[model samples]
Target: MLYQVALPLIPQVGGGTARTLVNYLGTPEAVFSAPKDRLAKIPRIGEVLVRSILANKEAALRQAEEVILRAEKEEVQLLYYTNTAYPDRLRDLPDAPLLLYYKGTANLNAPKVISIVGTRKSTEYGRVVTEQLVQDLVKHNALVVSGLAYGIDIISHRAALKEGLSTIGVMANSLETIYPTVHTRDAERMLQQGGLLSEFPFGTKPDAPRFPSRNRIIAGMADCTIVVESTSKGGSLISADIAHSYDREVMAVPGPITSETSQGCNQLIKSLKAVPYTRAKDLEELLNWDKALAPASLPKPVPALDLSGFPAEQQQVLRVLQQAGPTHIDVLSRHTQFTMGQLSSVLFTLEMSGLVKGMPGKLYGLV
Candidate 1:
């Protein structure tokens, strides 16, 4: 399966063209066996790729055999791209891997899946959301997918592991090695829960260019790709774009507009290009997920800010702020634990206390 397909793929320029030829030729074996003159006439069968395919016949066969033996010993299932079990969504893509080496029990064709992506410099917001959203997805029968990068990517994968959820990690490197090196333990755990996936064969080192192509597969495999956070330019958005091209759902969570890391998501929402989702529920509603949940809800933002020591006034203020986004001091007081007259005094005191800040809308936040 990989040999004939690989011939066309190696040429770089004609990779897509060769993939198309295989689509028409029916199978790699058939393509390889076709009469030379007959194969030559096909557009873009170009001499280079055709000759490579013809010349590498023995090497391809030996490689395939070795691959099968390795998979069998490791208990990994080796799937040809054309196999019925090959992910239908992925198979449709132009650069889909010619073969997949998978471990674990989750179906590649699972009914619900979403890719979680973000930057290496994950903020508090990205980490919180990725952890929460992945837990939520797993509870609702959705498998989590990610690139296994640091920060948001690994946060999502680790959360899935904690939740006892199956997860998949797409890699920019070949199966022979780990890219970050630090995440090898996490990757090992993932092999038990899900599997590692990549288009590159063994010994392909992680490269700068491979990341963009790698990101596309992460996006293409999922029903939707959720960017926990990204800058105005990064691989996550590139993946999002490919997901959109594949007609998959693209949803982004909004963040403070000032942060360069979140600008991409906010821009996506503003353009009315991707769905805006703040919490796990937002994703579920968009995907129309209906399933039982076993995991705990996301931990509160202020886990250590226990209100136990606070008086009713502060507690009430926090409660009101929870219902509202950020609240004005006077309005927060009026809505809870004080009259309008008392509210002004509390507002002044709270302002002096430095627990909150004023915004144009009279809104306040816990500083």
Candidate 2:
């Protein structure tokens, strides 16, 4: 679609005056090409909006042309709501984005798309659980989607790439600018591996308010939204709420009962709004993969642990740590009935092996 048609629809772009102009002229292209009396006949658009449209039209048109050219060069496909490529799930939403820019390998309407979402500050447990779930879903030909935030979002994307699965990162910013700056490299990688999608115009920054709006897209784009972990109140919960409003499945993995990070998931399950996601099968079972996948039924992922580099000693230490969290050295020694020296050495080896992490004041726990 032309910017002459698109730019005026930008609610805040032309301020209070433009809404009237759009109301009268029906579109900016009409306003731009209309005579002065024709413009004057509009309710409140006579002077200001007409002038704004007249002055801004050529420049807006030029910028729109540049966006189209950039999209062509970058291999990013543009999807207006009226276009066939626009996701059917999002089309019915009340406040859907006017346009979506995409670059990727898979179809936007892929049947098995699942949204993976969680807290920006994810714990080690959250990381493992999120990656494991993504690995399973992707193995079954599900498109793993997320908001491209830090923590769980980045982890899922990287894991999906490692497994050669399709990944989608929906951004709060525009195609020209990336949010959180740190993930620019991964965002670029996603465009090559899958794609980066956005509703914002070019050069839009990640303003704080835009995030909740962006979460709606992440919610709307998926058949189901899975929360790996979240705080009591956070973006993932908002996404889940929106998913419910859209009549999509909302699933969450339970964390430790004592964990502050797990509160969100627990609350969601407690409300009876979402089901506990214990395994990938739980998701697939409800997803009705036989119908979604049709003739190209997805192959189930092999349920197995990857222990390629784990040493026997390190593995034993991890087993002990898993059995008892925050174990004091003496307690651990007694529990395992190993000598203090053996336990100390084991902890050190485990720390170095990345199987265990040392907490504040020398407390050690399995990572």
Candidate 3:
């Protein structure tokens, strides 16, 4: 646990680098113990990073020990990327943080996770829509995720609480403090119902730059992201964009053109970056939530494919499609850990063999 927490504390070691080190060295402890010469030989390790790792190893461990002590005192759980408690939705994201601080009882890997985001300066219309949308989603048993900021973000959280649903507030700062202290009470309630999550450790401030990083987690940890309202620019749009890049579904609610808060969502829809969110059924259909909830006896089993003749990678892709139904290409790349070129080639081969069918929007499903 100490080494896992310490890996990210080393100077100049970003999430990607830390993951790379663990991938090559087998464990975080091995990364710290490896000789400088051995570390330097790994691709992209570079001389500077190798030296930094060696020189800061002890310091990082000391900082990690302190962090663990504080975490224990606060009853915070440290979620390393490989830990079973880590959100599966985020595990495959290349840029996901290596460690997260989580506190709450809600399952992080809930079957249905939906992020609700929008402008901090929300209007009455936005509030009504956000609340109604969440209420409608109760039947789907969706877990709500949001930034815990003012306006739509907080409204969504409060609405979820009212509806008896678990909602996670992904914060930019450490769990020790909630920004915009007015929402502290709501956050406390969330601790009992849902929970708070953050990649930053204790004492980290909610700085401007950290919000975008926080937005990615809100995007990555969910099956989809919905924008209730926003202006031309804001953290909500950033979250939508991140979700889109992850190949996760993104939905934006349409609003009056005259309203400034509606422009961002309008623009997102116009650019074909997001689907227009009208009602809860839109989500239920897009994610097959209704089908998932249907009685088991009502569904037919997928026929087994002859995977014995296919290459290992091809079989793996087939198996994923069989289990997940239709999946986007980018998602396939993440799940299979294959580069785009590699996944594309493999998909083409499968398509040619009639074992897979390519759908619109780069989605592929087993035939």
Candidate 4:
């Protein structure tokens, strides 16, 4: 655990690099202990990063120990990328944080997760739409995620709480303090239902640059990201863009063209970057949440598949998909225990064979 926490602290060691080191060297501790010559030989581990690892080993471990102690004192959970508790949605994302500081009881991998994001300067219409959307989502038993900033973010969280739904607030700063201090009380209330999550460790301030990094987490951790309102530019649009890049479902509320706050959403719709969100039903249809939430007894028994002609890997993927209905690639990888490369190859073959179809948000289902 100490080595897991320390690996990310080394400068220039992003999530992808850290994963590569762990994959090649066998473990974080092994990566730290490897000789400089050996480390340099690994792909992409240049002289500078190798030197940084060797020079900062002890300091990084010390910092990691302190971080662990503070996290314990604050009752925050340290979610390493490889930990079982870590979010699977983020597990395969190239830029996902290697470590997260989470304080909450809600399941991070809830079957239905949606992030609602928008401008800090929100209008009454935005608030109403956000609240109504959350309320309607209660029937689907969805978990809500948001940045917990002012305006629509807070409105969504509060609405989720009122609707008896769990809602997670992704933070740009550490768990030690909530930004926009006014939301502190609301955040505290969330600890009982959902909770606050952050990639930043304790004492890390909410600097300007950290918010965009924070936005990626919000985008990566959910199946869909909905922008309720925004101007031509704002953090919410940034979150939407990040979500789109991740191949996650992105939705934008269509507001009046005359309204300044609607410009960003209108532009996204015009560009075909996002679907127009009018109500919760749009989300349900996009994500197939209605079918997912249907009573287990109601599903028709799947007919046995004749997979004899397919390769073993393809057969395995088909069986899982048959049982799981629409599944994300990450989930398929976990169930099949296939590496991404192997899973992609098998899925590609099945797709070309007309046995599988791709769905929104990187999901795959029977054709």
Candidate 5:
């Protein structure tokens, strides 16, 4: 755990590079212990990163130990990316954090997760729309996720609590303190139902640069993200952009054109970048929540596929999906022994043919 948490803190080991190192070396400890010459030979990893790793190995490990201790004292759970408890949706992201410090009762891997973000200077109309949407989400037993800031963030969290739905606040700072101290009490109230989560360790202040990375979690952890209101530029729009880049569903509430806060949503809608969100049911329909709500039953055998004319690679992927039963894309890649690019092409073809279904969080199932 120390190695896992500390390796990413290396000067040159970013989330993407960290994952690459683990993929190549099998573990953080091995990555650190590997010869510099060998490490430098890996694609994209250069001499500078190798030297950085060697030079900072001791300091990074020491910091990791301190952070782990603080987490233990605070009763916070450290979620390593490889852990089963880590959000599967987040794990699929190439830039996912190496570890997350979470202090919440709500399951991070809840069956239904929806992220809500909007302008911090939200107006009453935005608040009312957000409240109604969250209220409607209650019936579907959705877990609401947000940044826990002022305005629409607080509104979404409070609405979720009012509806008895668990809400997660993904913080930009450490779990030790909530930004905008005025919302601290509300954050405490959230602990009764949902919990606070962060990738930053203790003593890390909420600086300007951290929020964009924070927004990625808000966007990545859910099956879809809804922007209640945003201006032409803001963190909410950034979250929507990240979600779209991740291929997650993105929605935006339509607001009056006269309002600046509505411009972001309008632009997103106009550009065909996001679905226009009107109500909770619209979101539910878009996500196919009814299918998710159906009773669980024994896994069925994959239906027969007449792939005589299909390429061997596509046929191989179909057979793997047939046997695996709604497997994650990573697992599909491993089972089929196909590269991500190959797997994506095969899955796209199957989806286009109506032979397979793509679920949120990079899951695929036979149709």
Candidate 6:
């Protein structure tokens, strides 16, 4: 535990470098015990970084011990990346944090996970959408994930609690300090239904640079990311980008074209970078929620066009999905003899028409 926690603290040894070292050396303890000459010869270790690790080894070990003690006192759980209890989705990321300090009852590996993020200065529309989306997710038994910031992040947590769903707040700082300090009460409430999680250890301040790293956990822990509101640029957008890079489902709530907070969502949709999230069922369908759960969450059935009304090409696609059940987009195209781009447009129309649902891993099925 000491070596695992201390490895990432060594100067110049980031998550990626630590992972590389651990991968090559078999363990964090092995990396530290390897001879200086042997460490210097590892692909990217080089002599300078090896010397830095060697020089800081004692101090890092001390820091690690202090963190372990703090965890005991504060009731924090130290989740090593290799631990089975650590979030499985997050472990898939190449640069995933080596250590996480978690305090909460909610399972990090909850079957259904989705992050809702937006601007700290979110507008009323954003709040309403966030609340409704979180409430709707209850039927799917989803765990709402957010950054625990002002506006949409806190709103997401509160809505999840109100709806009796689990929610996780990924913190940029250590468990010892809540940044902005305003959400401390909300964090306390979250412990009942969810919890606050951080990759930083005790005594670590919530600095600006630490946020992007925190954002990854928010992005990586979930199966998808939803940006409720954002300007042209912000941390929420960063989270969306990271989630997309991880090949997770990305959705955006569209706002008025002129609203500053809506620009990011509009851009994401306009560029086809993210799906246009107009209703909660958009998420439900995209995530492939069980058919039985839909009736409980949705107010009404998705309005689907009769098979006779759809163009013959779309009807053909639907017929294939009906017969094949859930099938990959590539398989759909091959069976229907449609080109990839052509099949995509057909599927999009069918999806918007409520006849088809898209699943993760590029699979599609009838709604």
Best by TM-score: 4
lDDT of 2 by residue, 1-367 (tens): 6753356343344323443554467864665687877876777554665566556667777777878877788777888655677776675555666568877766677756788899999999998998788778765777888988988888898888888888889988887777778888888788777788887767778898888888898998887898888899978899999988865789988888899889999999999878899987777666655334457665554333345567665565566667665543434554565655677788887778676786531245666
Q: Which of the two, 3 or 4, has more lDDT? A: 3
Per-residue lDDT, model 6, residue 178, is: 79
Off by over 4 Å in 3: 293-303, 319-341, 358-365
- Each model's lDDT comes to 0.72, 0.74, 0.91, 0.90, 0.88, 0.86
Candidates in order, TM-scores: namely 0.72, 0.68, 0.92, 0.93, 0.89, 0.81
Cα RMSD, model 3: 2.5
RMSD of each: 18.8, 21.6, 2.5, 2.1, 3.2, 9.1
Q: lDDT (0-100) at residue 286 of candidate 4? A: 85
The candidate scoring highest on lDDT is 3
The TM-score measured for candidate 6 stands at: 0.81
> What is the lDDT ranking, best to worst?
3, 4, 5, 6, 2, 1
Q: In candidate 1, which residue pairs clash?
A: 327-364, 328-362
The residue-by-residue lDDT of candidate 4 on 163-227, one tens digit each, is 99999999999988889899999999999999999988678899999899999999999988999
Across residues 1-367, which tens digit of lDDT does each residue of candidate 3 receive? 9999999999888788889999999999999889988999988899989889989999999999999999999999999998889998898788989999999999999878899999999999999999999998898778999989999999999999999999999999999999989999999999999999999989899999999999999999998899999999866999999999987899999999999999999999999999999987787777767665677874578777777887899988988898898887767887898987799899999899888898654578987
> What number of clashing residue pairs does each candidate have, in the order they appear?
2, 0, 0, 0, 0, 0
TM-score of 1: 0.72
Q: Quote the positional error of residue 232 for candidate 6 in Å.
A: 0.7
Rate residue 180 of model 1 by lDDT: 90
The superposed Cα distance between candidate 5 and the true structure at residue 361, in angstroms, equals 10
Worst 10 residues of 1 by lDDT: 5-14
Clashing pairs in 2: none
lDDT of 4: 0.90
lDDT of 1 by residue, 1-367 (tens): 4454344334342335655666667776666577767667778667775676667655666766666666678676666666777776676566666666566667788767788888888899888888888767765677889998988899998999999888898888877587799999998988888878876655579989889878878987887898879899866888888887765678998999899889999988888778998877676656545322344576457533466676777666756655675654434553674755566565566668776565532356665
Instruction: For candidate 2, report its TM-score.
Output: 0.68
